[model samples]
Structure formats: structure tokens, C-alpha cells
Target: MVELAICSSNFTDQLALLSFKSSINFDPNNVLSNWTQETDFCGWVGVLCSRRRQRVTGLILRSMGLQGTISSHVGNLSFLRVLDLRNNSFHGHLTNEIGRLLRLRLLVLAENNLTGTIPPSFGNATSLKIIALARNYICGRIPTELAQLPKLQIISLSDNYLTGPIPSGLFNILSLSYLLLDANQLNGQLQAFPNNSLQFLDLRFNELSGPIPLLVATNFLISHNKFTEIPLALCNVSSIKILDLSHNSLSGVIPQCLGNFSNVLSVLDLRMNDFHGSIPTSFVEGNKLRSIDLNGNQLEGKVPRSLATCRHLEVLDFGNNNINDTFPYWLETLPELQVLVFQSNKFHGPMGSSKTQLPFPKLRILDLSHNEFSGFLPTTYFKHFKAMTIINETVGLRYMGESYYHDSVTIMIKGLEIELPGILTIFTTIDLSHNKFSGEIPNVIGKLYALRLLNLSHNNLVGNIPSSLGNLCSLESLDLSSNQLSGKIPSQLTSLTFLAVLNFSENHLEGHIPRGNQFETFDNSSYNGNLALCGFPLSKECEDNKTQLHPTPMLHKEDDPTFACGFCWKVVQIGYGCGMVLGLVMGYIMFLIGKPKWFVRIAEGEQQKKGKRSHKGGNRNGGRRK
Candidate 1:
């Protein structure tokens, strides 16, 4: 009887497994091909059975490209402990029957097409510890019953359509550690929580408002919201590592105690805020700080020299601020430093020559546009931008970041501000436009082969555009407009195949524009205000010495409207001369016949008519082309 009872239980479990296999309408990988009665159900591809009872305890079918709704019969597997179906196309509402698995601990369905609200019956699964359903379309408020789970530790439902304020009971769960609810529509002010086990809390990309409540976490992200202030209690948490409060309306001066966080913090992002006052200048030595972004703020004062203590620093941005200071050449000592932005500030004085031979050796991006800096381009620094000049083809693409914090930077590309989520190692740019700098662009700039965008416009710079710039094979946008640059557009520039946005407008450039490659794609707007520029795009045609010496006998399609009008005048002049000769000949004959007076009157009338006709034709021909 005992053996028969065990066999019956095994058969029941197999039936439930088969039910799940039947529900999957599509399995392109054929992962469940051998899931049949001929084979032992315990031997199935994703099946895991207990040794004693031979009962299915786990179903690990993650990332098999499986598509279909999960079968409700899955709840019949009473001994099921792990149900992982992550990174699949599993769709439709989650089966409420899954809540019947009393032994279920881990339920992962992340990166799927699953929709509808989470099953409230999940509260019955008391054994559940982790419930990950991130990167799905799951909507509606998080069920408060989930907090009732005695052992629930992680609730990862990020990148979903979940709404409503977080259940206060979730914070009360002593075992809960991570609460990832980012990229959702959850609104309302946060309530104070007395939890101590919570370590990683991400509520970014949401509509949460009001003052931030008391919180203690190692990694805290609450950006892209309307939070107005940072609780002083947050600074008291000495164990914080990553604190990103960027893209918020948080005002007032940054707390000085934040500098103390450098000892443990690796990333401290406070960008796109209204925080005024000078940056904290107490970054201690031996700090683990890797990325520090304080851009788009109203902060004023010089960059503190104390930052040199952060030997691991990689990214440093202070763009679009009120800070006034000269170039901080001392920053070149840091070996890992890559991105340094100070665009749109009161940074005045010359970028004096670096005393070191290889200053900013690893620097890939250097933006100082819209400043009061006046001098020639920093040629010496250009020579030492080893990161931009060298290409490590062996290394695959990578971004600058530290742990969970992906570094971001804002740059002006083609007259628009664009924010990059992460800075790739190979991406490079040099923007020094809208300054009082004067002098020729450096030829050494050509050596930086990895350069993508180069903006040197709106400056008092003079002299020829560097023909050596042709060597920048990766350059996409080149803006050298609004300068006193005079010379022929270098024919060598035709080699830049990747050039997209070219602006040479409002300059004294005089020559036939380059015709081949990407240059041919530019329009008259690119060469506007360059009166002497002539090419296919422009109405003006380049004149050869012969074309100037001898008038064109006929109008050409490529001829300028003004030149065609002149040609018309010349033709009229020739006809008028011939008519006069003919009239004189006629008069001579008429005079012999004593009819000279009538012939003279006819000739004068013909001359007046010819003049009127010529004047009308001139006006029509000289008008600007639409």
C-alpha cells in the first residue's frame, strides 16, 4: 500500500509537469523536446527533483525563448521550491494558483513580456524569500500582503508600470534588504521607515515628491523627481557607497559632511539640481571616490585643490555653473582621469602651457566652451591626450563607471544639449568654442585620431583652418564658424568620410569648396556669409582666367545669376552696335534718294525701343533665384 501511494504521488507530479509543457505554445530552442511520458518526468531538461520523494522541486527555464502563459497546473507541484522563468517571452497574467506552492522560495520572472497585476494570493507563499518580476509590464499597486511574508528579503519589480505609494508594511519587514522599484509611476511622498536591514533602495525615474524621509542604505538612487531637500540624517549613514540624487529640484547648499563620505563612497552624483554655494572642499585622502558629477548647478567658487586626494577619481564635471577659476592644471596627476568638463563657466585666463610632458595622459574629453578663456588652443595638452590618440583595438568597448552607478555626462552636440548615460572609452571630443581665444588651431590636433566632435566656433581665432584636420578619420562634427579664418577649404578635408555636421559659415574663407566625399552633402547654409566661396551648392561658379578674360558667349546652367545678367548686357550691347551700323547704311541709301529725315526718325525710335527691351531683360535676369 505504501509503495502504491508513493507511485501515485509521482504520477500526479508528472501530470502537472506535462500540463506546463502543454501550455508553452512556442519553444524554438526545443528545450522541452524530451518532456514526454516515455522519459521520467524527473529527467526533464529544466526539472529538479528531491532525492527522497522523487518530486519536482525546481523548474529553471530561464532564457529559453519560451513563449506562452504559465500553466495554472504549476501550483499542483506541491514540493516546488524554485520557479525561475526569467528572460523569456512568457506573457499574460501570472497564474494565481502559483500562490499555493507552500515550499516556493525564489520566484524570478524578470525580463519577460508578462502583464497584468501581481497576484495578491502571493501572500499565502510564506516560504518566499525573493520575488523578482522586473523588466515586465506588471501594473497596479504592490499588494500589501507581500509584506506579510515572514522571510521575504527582496522585492525586485523595477522597470514596470507599478503605481501608488509603497506599502508601509514593506519597510517594516525586518528581513527585507533590497527594494528595487525604479522606472515606475509610483508617486507620493515617502514615509519615514525604521528599517535597518534595507541596503539597496532605488526609486529613481519616478514621480515621488516632498522632502526625502529618513533612510539608511548603502546604495540610494532617487533622481528624476521633485524631491526638494536631502534629509541631514542621510549624511549620518557612514556606510553609504553610491548616492545619486541627480535630475531633481533639490536646492540649498550641499552638506559639508558629504565630503566625509569619500572614505566609503565610490559615486556621488548631484547633477541637474539647483544647489548653490561652493563645492565641499574636504575630500579626504585614500578615498574610494571614482565619479563625482556636480554639473548644471548654481555653485560658485574655485575647484578645491583637496580633490587631489581622490586617487581613484575617473570622471569630474562642473559644467554650466557660476564657478570662476583658471585651468586646474594640477588635475593631470591623476592617471585614471578620463572625462573633465568645465563648459559654460567664468573660467578666464589662458590655459597656460603644462609644465609636465604628458599632462592629462588619459583624458578623452576636454570641453571648455562658452568661457572667458582667451589664448591659442592648448597644443601641448593636445599632444599628451594619449587616450584619444591611441587605439587599443584588442580591448572591447567599455564604459566608465563604478559598480551599480553608471556615470553620465552632458555635452553640446550640433547646437543641442545631449546627455550620455555612460561615456565609452573610445569616445573623444574637444569643444573650446564661444570663447575669446584667438590664433590658429593646432596641427597636433590631427594626431587625436579618435576625436568625434571638434567645436572651435565663435572665437576671435584667425589664420587658416588646419589642413592637418583631414587626418581626424573619426571626426563627425566640425564647427569652425564665426571666426576670422581665411583660406581655401582644404581639398584634403574631402578624406573625412564620417564628417556629418560641418559649419564654416561667417568666415573669410575664399575658394572653391571641396567637392568629393561628405563635403558634397553640405548645402549653401554651411558656407553662408563666405562671400568668396564658390561651388556646386553655391550660386557662384569658380571662374578660370580664360572665362574672365573672354566673355561667355552662352549662359551655362552653373552660372551665377549676377554673371548671367552681365552676359545678357554684353549680348544686347553687340546687337545695339550692329543695329546702329545697319541704320547708318540705310540712312546713306535714303540720303541718296533725299529721304534722310524719315530714315533718321525711324532709327531713333528703334534705338529707344531696343533700350527699353534691354532694360526689362536686365531686371528679369538680375533678380535673385528663389
Candidate 2:
């Protein structure tokens, strides 16, 4: 009994010494105040010991915001099995002496500021099963010595600056179930991935180039690299559930075999690549698919009808493509749809009526701009939308009465008085221009008192500018250009004190331009394309027009009937006609002087045919044929 007591006391002394040394380097706040030899080692703050068997088994001090180095004396804790010091400010080199803890199984040092190479002596801890050092500043190649740990199962070293080839030694670890090396500077051909026991693998955001290796992992991520082609071998992984290969330089048609992953795939992202060709009809047949991101590709053709059956789909991004077809009405039937981004495409047709329903009750973001969609703006589109930003610039959205105007006004209705419930008004903007929309600028637009920007340019809109627009107190930008609008410049617009940018160019507007704070800073370009407009910026004086005509409040027809009757009409018509004639004459002269190669080719072809016919006639004259 005496000899056994002596052996136990010796072990306890070693552990106490190690803990004391490590604490000295990190106890900046002195929170480990009671860590002393006089007190039993089990009484320490994070120290855990077996009750009946008086031996320390675990030491957990995670997220204490602790700072400083991990001392080498930590090796003295021979019986410690688990050490968790994650999510702290721990720094300095991970000491090689840590290998002395032969019984250690789990070591989590993730989310720290630790730097330096992984110590090779870690291989001596044969019992170690999991080691996570992710989101740290750790550098240097993974030591080949780690392969010696026979019982190792999970190793995550992601989000670090570690470089060099993925150590082949990792593949040899047959017990490794989860391996993550993403967001690192590692490079080399992706090969030798362990097929067995590996359930999860992430190698994303690396310098890896070449085809993806076939592995049995269920969750695979290898995005943001320079891979030039889809790894058909990935199709071999029948167990894959989530596959992400976005932001690569991959080109070529998406393989039809991708549909074969229907058995288990739930999320598949292949966005931002050079992929071209029609989207496969068989692509979304999988019932389990929850999310599909194929944006920023060159895919064409209509969306497949089968996608409507994917009941679990929550997000779908098919933006920035050449997809030319009518909007998919079937999309309105999706119950779980939350985010749908279809910008920069060639989709035509009206947003369906059923879309106004609560199909996407949880929808947060819906972007469908820069497309060929046409028709009136949908009023009920935002009834269930918590927040949204929809732009229809390239589309042909014609004005459909004052109701559409009210819909635009709803975006600015904010503050507690509006009783918006849980919805805190964030950013909501509308851009409707470069289309065939027409009619007078609606006076109701000013009611959207919260409006930040209003753009109505490059359209056929006609009528006097609405003075009520000045009510938009929050408006920062207002554009009303390239229209047939005719009227005096509204002095009420000067009331828009917050307005920073205003454009009223390319219209038939005439009179003295409004001056003051925001308008005074504007140059001639802001008021250009308007023939009769005269003010401080223009060389023509406002007094010149008032002197020639009698002051009439109703703007009589006799008062310069055609508006800019004498000056504008003559200048524009003569300038356009002369420019057109000049261009045609110059083109004709160039064609005559420098005969193109195509013209010479046509002449040569005609001469060759004539020669062949003459030869045939000569043979007939020589009595070769009757």
C-alpha cells in the first residue's frame, strides 16, 4: 500500500507542475486563481477528474478569451484524454512536448491565433482520434509524421495559411472519417482521396487545379479554384448529398450524368463558370433537392418543367445567363421558395397572377432585373414579401393607370405610424426605365415619402412634371429624361432639399430652370436636349423669350405656338439630315476607292464560270458532240 501511494503521488505532482507552467503563460485575467499545489488538482477551474478513481481525465477552458502561449510543460499531464481550448486568443507555437500525453484522444485548438508548423512529435500520441486546428494562423506543410497515428478519425485544419501539396500521408489513414482542409493556400493535383470511412471532405478555396477525384464522401466541397472541367469522376460517388464546385474556370457542357446524382443530392452549386449549353431537362428530377445555384453561366433554353416538383427547394439562382424563354409560371407553386435570383437573362412574359399568392410566404429576396419581361407592374407582388428589390429596366413595363403608381409609393411608407408590425423597413428601391412606359408622371409618387431614388428615363412619357414630387423628402436621386414631356420647369422641385442628383434632360421642357441649393450646382448637361429651356447655364437669356411674347398664364397657342418653334425645330431637323447624308456619301466614296476582297472574289467567280462554258462550246464546234 505504501509503494502504491508513492506512485500515485508522483503522478499527481507531475500533472500539477505542468498545469502550473501552462497557466503562468495564459492567466492574464488571473481567473485560474485557485490553481495551487496546496489544493487538490481536481479542484482547478476547468480540470475534470474521475470521482472514484482520483485521476484527471479532461481539461476544458474554451472561450475564456485567454491569451498567451501554450507552455511545453503541458506534456506532463500523462493521464489527460481531452483538451479543449477553442475560440480563444491563444498564440505562439504548439509545443512538440505535447506528444508526451500518451493517453490524449481529443485536442481542439480551433479559432485561435496560434502560428508555426504542426509539431511532428504529435505523431507519438497514438491514442489521438480528433485534432481540430481550424481558423488559426497556422502555417507550413502538414507533417507526414501525422500518418503514424493509427486511431485518428477526424482532422480539420481549414481556414489557415497552410501551403504545399495535400500530404498523401492523410489518405493512408484508414480511420479518418472527416477531413477538412479548405480556405488554405494548398496546391497540387487532387488525387489519392481515401474512399473508405471518409464521410465528409471539404477542400475548397485552394490553389488546386485538375479534375476532382472520385471519393465516397457524402458532403463534398471544392469551390473557388481554377479547375477547367467538371470531374465526371464525381458522378461515381453514389453517396454524395451536397456538392459545391462554384467560382471555378470550368468550361464545356454540363454533363447529363449529373442527373444521376438524384438519389442523394440535396444541394448542388456550379455557379460562376464558363459552362455553356442548354440546361438539361433531367437536371432537377431529384425530389430531395433543396437548393440549386447555377448562376453566371452561358446556359440557354427554357427552365425545365420538372423543377416545379422539387417541393423542398428553398433557393434557386439562375442569374446572368442567356436563357431566352417565357417566365416559368410553375415557379409560383413552390411552397418553400425563399430566394429566387434571375437577373441578367432573356426571360419574357408577365410575372404570373398566382405569384402574388403566399406561395413564397418566407421569401426574403427576389431579383429579376435586366430581362425581357413585359407588362404592367404587379401590385400584390409585395403583399407577402418581407423585403425585396425588383428592377425591370430592359423589360417592356408600360404604365397601367394610377394603380401601378400607388404600388411604387408603398416602398417609402415607413415609421411606427405605418404600423408595419415586425417588418423594420430596410432598403427597398425600384428601377423602371429604358422601356416603352408612357403617360404623365404620377402625382401619387410623392406619397412614397420614404423613396430614396426614382428613375424614369429613356421612355415615351408625356405631360407636365408633377409638382407633388417635391413631397419625397427622403429622395436622393430623381431622373426624368429622354421623354416627350412639355411644360415649364417645376419650381416646386426646389423643395426637395435632400435631392443630390437630378436629371431633366432630353425633353421639350421650356422656361427658366429652377435655381438654388441642389439645382444651382447642376451644369448644362443636366438640362440638355431641351430646346426652349433657358436660364443661368444656357447662353440664351430667359428675358429674351418674355420680351418677345405677352405674359400669359395659360400658355396661349399664339405665344410661340410650337414652343421652340423657330430655333429648336430648325436646328435638330437640319443637323440630323445633314449628318445622315454626309455619312452615306462618305461610305459610298470609300467603297468606290478601296474595292473590298469580297467584291474581287465575286468577279473572279463569274469569270471562271464564263470560261468553263466557252470551253464546252468549243468542244461542241469541234464535232466532239452532235
Provide the overall lDDT of each model, using Cα atoms, as 2-decimal numbers. Answer: 0.79, 0.63
Least lDDT summed over 10 consecutive residues: which range in candidate 2? Answer: 400-409
The local distance difference test score of model 2 is: 0.63
Candidate 1: residue 88 Cα off by (Å) = 1.7
Cα displacement (Å) at residue 84, model 1: 1.1
TM-score, prediction 2: 0.66
Q: Candidate 2 lDDT, tens digit per residue, 463-556?
A: 9987666555445567787878899887756655556566789999998887665776677878889989897677768865553332323433
Over 502-593, each residue of candidate 1 has an lDDT whose tens digit, in order, gives: 99999999978877768778898888999988866888988851222212223243222223222323433334222222233334344333
The numbered model that scores best in TM-score is 1
RMSD of 1: 22.1
Give the range where candidate 1 is weakest over 10 consecutive residues by summed lDDT: 617-626
Clashing pairs in 1: none
Task: List candidate 1 segments past 4 Å from native.
Answer: 545-626
